[model samples]
Target chain A: MSAPDRFAPLPVTDTPQERGDAARNRALLLDAARRLIAERGAGAVSTDDIAAAAGVGKGTLFRRFGSRAGLMVVLLDENEKAHQQAFMFGPPPLGPGAPPLERLIAYGRARLAFVHDHHALLSDAGRDPQTRFTGPSALHHTHVRVLLQSAGTTGDLDAQTTALSALLDADYVEHRLAEGATLDELGDAWETVAVKLCGR
Target chain B: MSAPDRFAPLPVTDTPQERGDAARNRALLLDAARRLIAERGAGAVSTDDIAAAAGVGKGTLFRRFGSRAGLMVVLLDENEKAHQQAFMFGPPPLGPGAPPLERLIAYGRARLAFVHDHHALLSDAGRDPQTRFTGPSALHHTHVRVLLQSAGTTGDLDAQTTALSALLDADYVEHRLAEGATLDELGDAWETVAVKLCGR
Candidate 1:
């Protein structure tokens, strides 16, 4: 008996308009959440409140986002993607155009800046342990791993990648923020550590 | 008038018997907890049940250990202090007599071993964020920081300490454990990283 192929392509649907509508609604929900968080706080904003604020029904809100944490996750996802894109493709040492080691240093700096700038959103979204541990996109890890490899780090690239991931772990970053460390200092320190980890 | 002295002698008392009693009770409570966790797991063991298992009243149990999380913390404290002592003063590469780098590596290995052996206790005790975050004795940040300093780590010791602490953060460690990495691998990898950070 031959093994079944799992690679059969499924029929594709042209759902451009549907996708656009979903995107718009997501923006509205996120905007509503931010407004609520700004006016009150992340803890003060519930799914029901977000739905009412967004002018959508609670059921629709749940259908779209699943839960309050899920909605917060979407907010974080939007910001994280934006940051990732900026670092991966946008400009300067953080973008595709820089020397590999320079890019690695810039990535850490940019990441520290991002975390500092969006402290509240990250904290609120990461309150759920499941979300904290696994909600981050694989791209985030991949992005750093690629940079480490490109930077010519010696000895066990996988271990270096894991160590780098630990550096970017949300809770650790948040703790530094809570300790009142400045973003610039964090960025500088990260550059130092990154250089050491990546070599002379 | 002279400038008043800012410090005063601590009021001291001999409480040897009281200390001994506390230690015995602590052992009893921890044993009860271990048994309960064995039978029903950490989630199922309540403070009341713990008190009953140890043949003590809930008030006595709470007085001795403030909450269920606190009780768990005390249990972990015993284990942590033991490990701390071993690294700080016990013998060989983990003790004061070894080369700084060797001691650092040994300390990491010992720490990993401790976590592996006390996995359930740490997990259970750390259920409450407040319990995990606060308390002078609970967070081992300072201990690790001191070790890094003594190991002759170059540059900003404070920053390196925080970065090193990030490496050992419980959430990250637990996540890695769940991802199927062995304790020995973690210990070895961390030994490498610690040596790098210590500029060995």
Candidate 2:
């Protein structure tokens, strides 16, 4: 397909084969990109490399994701969704089954682990301030708000939400880790904050 | 003196007249810069404008501050020192002699108020990430670390310090203000975090 035609097929009541072909191509591209990221890390993977690996033209890569940053965002979105699921429904201490205080602590620990696991992806997403503030992972805001509500905070919801923003400040995280703080310690302190702020 | 030569006088054994002149010039430049900042926020003020206002050549301004961002840092330092003092010695809840928990709460309230009062200064200093991170006013880190220690946290001091860093994250503060959070709410939350972390 031509560069322009890639986006042209959207929402079309078209032949099933074309749609199937497009879906297969997308999967191929995504799988190849994932392999590259796993092998060499996000910074090492280039769009040309992804295209070459997937056997698609450079135009196809551009058409799929507007830029390298956009691709990173996609990869991060998948990671975020999985993390969100783990917290929302997958297991104890992090999911719905644990006590509120424990859950809060568990949440922080899990989040730190996830951040460490996907350090490059998260950091890349954060480079663009606009994206960090407004991207769909804005689920971050929602997640904390819900947790605070669960913990019995009766204060202003907006303030609670803003406080959550601070929890994600990268410099603070970097400084803490650099200062020799461990994941367990951070998790415990967050649990303390969460318990105090939300009560019981 | 030329900009380079201006700094060359820093190591003098004794140059009373030069010292006096330098002092007077510094005062004049700072006064003029403050007036300009008050009349038109920090963004509107420039090195050239400050020099014109102070009736000094541009070289003098550059020589004195090193850069426009440095000038903002100095301006911010004055207010930062005063706020630091209040928490160190001012009054009940925020200053010396209060119960540690109450004092911690007061510190947050005081900081929130400080941010409100010096919103322009904070905004200006934040423009340069380097200044924001390394500026002299980062004494908040020290202050917070001391408070956490006094409050009886028994964990690794390094971890406690990291927790303190999270408490002072700038994004957290700005997010609170942007959400129209009241000074009381910020103070209350800070107190809550302090108490929880301190085991009070």
Interface RMSD of each: 3.1, 4.7
- Model 2 shows how many backbone clashes? 0
Q: Which stretches of candidate 2 lie over 4 Å from their true place?
A: A1-79, A89-100, A117-133, A153-168, A195-200, B1-36, B43-71, B91-93, B124-133, B154-178
- Judging by lDDT against the true structure, name the best candidate: 1
lDDT of 1 by residue, B71-153 (tens): 77766775677777877679978877877778777776777667666665666565554665554233466666777788777
Candidate 2, residues B43-145: lDDT per residue as tens digits? 6888788889898888888777667767777888887777777888788778888876667667767777777677666655654545655675456756776
| A110-169: candidate 1 lDDT, tens digit per residue | 877776667666666655556655565456667777888888777645456666655554
Root-mean-square deviation per candidate? 6.5, 9.6
Query: Which ten-residue region of model 1 chain A has the weakest summed lDDT?
Result: A8-17
Clashes of each: 0, 0
Q: Judge the docking of candidate 2 as incorrect, acceptable, medium or high.
A: incorrect
